[model samples]
Target: MAARVDVKLAELGISLPRPMQPIANYVPYVVTGNLVVVSGQVPAIDGKIAVTGKVSWSVSVDQGKEAARLCFINVLVHLKAACGGDLDRVRRVVRLGGFIASPSEFTQQALVMNGASDLAVAVFGEAGRHARTTIGVPSLPADAAVEVEGMFEIE
Candidate 1:
């Protein structure tokens, strides 16, 4: 049987890709005590950047939202690994940090970040409601439209 979170993802028509390997010197996730800290994830599908460039410039707001969503899915991938492939071990989504690549005038980072936030709630239900910080950045690695990192409490 699938885990409840996996079922939820399937219901949403999302099939998580293989977790992306860290491109730099950091591990994908680190478990300390009962917490799992996921390194920032970019919008990637099948090991390729799915979305790139800045929002409100090369990427539309809607596309940016989708990018954010993909980033969150990647976060989940790492989280699942940290939990030993059992998402059921997750207790709560502690926090999410969002970075939106956007122009200096772009002020809708929160709205764009909702893509990830909404998916989190849908996947984890009440436990998904989490504190978040979203900010616009001038650029990101690989020019990804959005990046997300998370902290999760696990059993």
Candidate 2:
């Protein structure tokens, strides 16, 4: 039987891709005590970067939001692996950090991060409401429009 979260994802038409492998010398997630800290995730779908470049410059706000959404989906993928393939083990979404690659003049980082935040709530409901920090950066790995990292409390 599929986990309830899996069913929810399906209902939302979200098809999680295979968890991305680390491009550098680091693991995708780290488990410490009862928490899993996921490394920053970019908008990679089907083993390719789906969105790249600076937000509001090379990428539009809507595209950046979609990239953020994909980043969260990737975070969930790492979280599922951390929980041994069971997302139900998650107790709470502790925090999420978002990095938006934008031009120096761009200032809608928070709005762009809403893409991931909204999905978090949709998937985890109240538990998904979490502390978050969003920042605009000049660039990110692969020039991804957005990158998201998360901390999840697990049983």
Candidate 3:
């Protein structure tokens, strides 16, 4: 079956752009056996970071959440590409890692990360849920307020 990710995206009125090329020296994704590991995805849209700076100081929590959502969308794009656009090839979402550029005192990492987690479940049903880590970071590439990475098990 083809990936339903695109359909869900269309339901949201979103169209995932082609996965962006890696910046710096790292590859964007790697497949090991049945597992596909996607590199950290910034909140970039159309090759540009949509928002920058630390949350609370320069960006709001809501904005960070939006960024997290975008990151997940990008992840799905890569997943679809890796599996030939067949989401049914996915067996499980093994894990997700999220980094939020925020003040050291901020304690809402879990909430911010949920933005992506919820979206995953929305698209893949129960298979979308996974082990996750949300951490507050001092900074990130392009000074993006949020970045998310994903891992999936393919059938």
Residue 111 local lDDT, model 3 = 81
Candidate 2 residue lDDT tens string, 100-142 = 9988889899999999999999998899999999999989987
Ranking by lDDT: 1, 2, 3
Model 2: lowest-lDDT 10 consecutive positions: 137-146
After TM-score superposition, the amount by which residue 4's alpha carbon in candidate 3 deviates from its true location, in angstroms, is: 3.4
Which stretches of model 1 miss by more than 4 angstroms?
A: none
TM-score of 1: 0.98
Best by TM-score: 1
Q: lDDT scores for all predictions?
A: 0.94, 0.93, 0.86
TM-score of each: 0.98, 0.97, 0.94
Q: Which structure among the candidates has the greatest lDDT?
A: 1
- Residue-wise C-alpha lDDT for candidate 3, range 130-150, written one tens digit per residue: 999999999998788899999
63-95 per-residue lDDT for model 1 (tens digits): 999999999999999999999989999999999
List, in order, the clash count of every candidate structure.
Answer: 0, 0, 1
Q: Which residue ranges in model 3 land beyond 4 Å of their true spot?
A: 1-3
Winner by lDDT between candidate 3 and candidate 1? 1
